[model samples]
Target: MSLYRVFDIAGTGMSAQSVRLNTTASNVANADSVSSSVETTYRARHPVFAAELSKAAAHQESAGVRVVGIVESEKPLTPEYAPNHPMADDNGFIYKSNVNVIEEMTNMVSANRSYQTNVRVADMAKQMLNQTLRLGQS
Candidate 1:
């Protein structure tokens, strides 16, 4: 692998974390939403990622991350009987979104730190390349 491949790997890491952040944000935004039916209720979404590894058979050894897909949680939604609520169904029940705020917040924190770590890695790679060029100058 080339020294420059570090940047590409770090970029993919950052991108995967960005997708995590976006999905977490979306889940948080819909956390308090109420729906008239279970079918229409919002569910938590999570991004799935896969790692791509270059094979030595092809004389490449760079590894990177990719988003496989985003999946909705299979957990059941909460239904409450609220006859007075405006959005209640004919049965006087409202379905609450299955997003857990605490869990989503934790995901946000983790993703933020991962993104920061990837930034530092890319920065370190750039510094190393610069130092090598400086050595040549000297």
Candidate 2:
């Protein structure tokens, strides 16, 4: 693989991490949200990642990460019997979001670490490129 391919791979990784972080934040923010119906209740979302193998193969390079889609959690919503709640249904049941704060926090940390790693990789590549340019100048 070429030195520049490092940048492409790391850039894609960073982009995917960004999406992960955004979705994690969204999930955390809606963790406590409640609604009258399941459809209106916020569902925990996660980004689906896949390897960009075809692109990498076409370029004669190894696969890089890509976010295929964002998927909502399939976990059942928590039902709270809060008759006084504004969003409570006729049965006095309010549907709380399935988002788990702890899970979201963990996901946030993972995404942050991945992002930092990608940043470091990109920075290293840039430094190496700069060093090579300096050698040519000298």
Candidate 3:
């Protein structure tokens, strides 16, 4: 693979991580939201990623990561007994969002780390290119 491909790969990685972080943030933000019905409760969302192959390279060579889609978590929503709450159902139960705050926090950290690593990779590639150019001047 060419050094230039590193830039493209790292860029795509950063982009994918950005989407992941956004979804994680959204999930966390709605973690405490309550609704009167299951249909009105917020569901945790997560970004789906897929590896794409580079057309310029061999079939097995990975081009970069792509976000296939965002999917809602299938976990059951938390039903709490809040008899005096405004959003309580007929049974005095309120459905809370399925978002797991701890899990979303973990995902946020992971996505942040991944994005930083990609940035470092791109920076190193730039430095290497600069040094190569300097070599011809000596």
Output the number of the TM-score-best candidate.
Answer: 1
Top-down lDDT ranking:
1, 3, 2
Count of residue pairs whose backbone atoms collide, per candidate: 0, 0, 0
- Compose the digit string of candidate 2's lDDT tens values, residues 1-138: 778989989999999999999999998888889999988889999989998879777878756898889998999999999999988999999999999899889899999999999999989999999999999998
Model 2 residue pairs with clashes: none
lDDT of 3 by residue, 1-138 (tens): 777889989999999999999999999999999999999899999999987875436664549989999999999999999999998999999999999899999999999999999999999999999999999999
Top lDDT model: 1
Q: Per-residue lDDT of 1-138 in model 1, one digit per residue for the tens?
A: 576989889999999999999999999999999999999999999999998874433557568899999999999999999999999999999999999999999999999999999999999999999999999998
List runs of model 3 lying over 4 Å from the truth: 54-62
Candidate 3 or 1, higher TM-score: 1
Note the residue pairs that clash in candidate 1.
none
TM-score, per-candidate, Cα-based: 0.94, 0.92, 0.92
lDDT of 2 at 25: 90
lDDT of each: 0.93, 0.91, 0.93
The per-residue C-alpha lDDT of model 1 at residue 73 equals 100
Alpha-carbon error at 9 in model 3, in Å? 0.5
